[model samples]
Target: MASSSVAGEPKQSRPGFFKRSVQFFKDAWGELKRVRWPNRKELTSYTMVVMGTCIFIILLIFGFDLGISYVLELIGLR
Candidate 1:
């Protein structure tokens, strides 16, 4: 059956590859221009916060794994 271009239904108009690519980059640049980039001090603080959180989580997971392994060893599983 032929496709129906009904009114009120959204029309799917896919542009050519080159047109789509150029539009994509233009949209990306436009979005980047609207971003609120941090200053150097804020950037450093944010970086440190992220790194500290990652380290804390890693240590937490390691402690749990170590405890589980010890318990398994006590039971002669490994």
Candidate 2:
């Protein structure tokens, strides 16, 4: 039977923690460079849209709660 490892050959070793950490940062920086970041104007527009949607949802929920409470109070449940 033949063996995979030769009698006197040195086996390959895995990368150490320091080398792996450096490689991780290198990969992260490469990905960041490829990203198409939004400009200031676009960021502002997006922020406004998110804020408006949140405010609308809050108001809708508040209206529902008030209506439910009013009905409950009238029926002596509150």
Taking all chains together, the TM-score of candidate 1 against the true structure is 0.79
TM, every model: 0.79, 0.69
Stretches off by above 4 angstroms in model 1 are 4-13
- Candidate 2's TM-score reads 0.69
Clashes of 1: 0
Backbone clash count, each prediction separately: 0, 0
For residue 27, give model 2's deviation from the true position in Å: 1.4
Clashing pairs in 2: none
What is candidate 1's CA lDDT for residue 45? 100
